[model samples]
Target: MSRHNIPDALWQRLEPLVCLPRKDPRGRPAKDARLMFNGVLWILRTGAPWRDLPAEFGPW
Candidate 1:
């Protein structure tokens, strides 16, 4: 309300989307999606093998 750079209509349009659920309901997230993706991406980026991942986070 105090004159920010972002437009009011954009805020209104994007507001509801902020509350959407991000992960599956059944199991614990184990890790947040973005972080998990980044870790997997790091592994792929570095060409690391699957056996290197931590116990709970691997082969699920």
Candidate 2:
């Protein structure tokens, strides 16, 4: 995992809290919650703008 990623132990606790569906019945499928969470953490940790989020974490 990258530095921005949540550790496996922490993710196990967080995974249950994320309630988003993998597939959206009305539109595009939902993005991976773990990845999105990591992206958000990266921004918060780095104090960077959303536009600067790396591609590995998905779109900003």
Candidate 3:
């Protein structure tokens, strides 16, 4: 995992709270919640603009 990635232990706890079903019949499939959450954390930690988010975290 990258330095910015959330730990597996912590992510296990947070996952249920933060994530919706991956396959939603009512709409398009959801993006990976953990990926998006880490992206948000990276931006908050670095104080960067949304456009500056790294590509590893997926589209900003």
- Which residues of candidate 2, in runs, are more than 4 Å off? 20-29
* Model 1 ranges with Cα > 4 A deviation: 1-24, 51-60
lDDT of 3 by residue, 1-60 (tens): 999999999999999888755564787554788999999999999999999999999988
The list of candidate 3 runs beyond 4 A from truth reads: 20-29
How does each model score on TM-score? 0.36, 0.77, 0.82
Query: Per-residue CA lDDT of candidate 2, range 1-60, in tens?
Result: 777788999999998888545564787654687888888888989999999999998887
lDDT for position 27 in model 1: 68
TM-score of 1: 0.36
The order by descending lDDT is: 3, 2, 1
| CA-only RMSD, every prediction | 11.2, 2.4, 2.4
Residue 9 lDDT in candidate 3: 100
Candidate 1 displacement at residue 40 in angstroms: 0.9
The positional error of residue 57 in candidate 2, measured at the CA in angstroms, is 0.5
Best by TM-score: 3
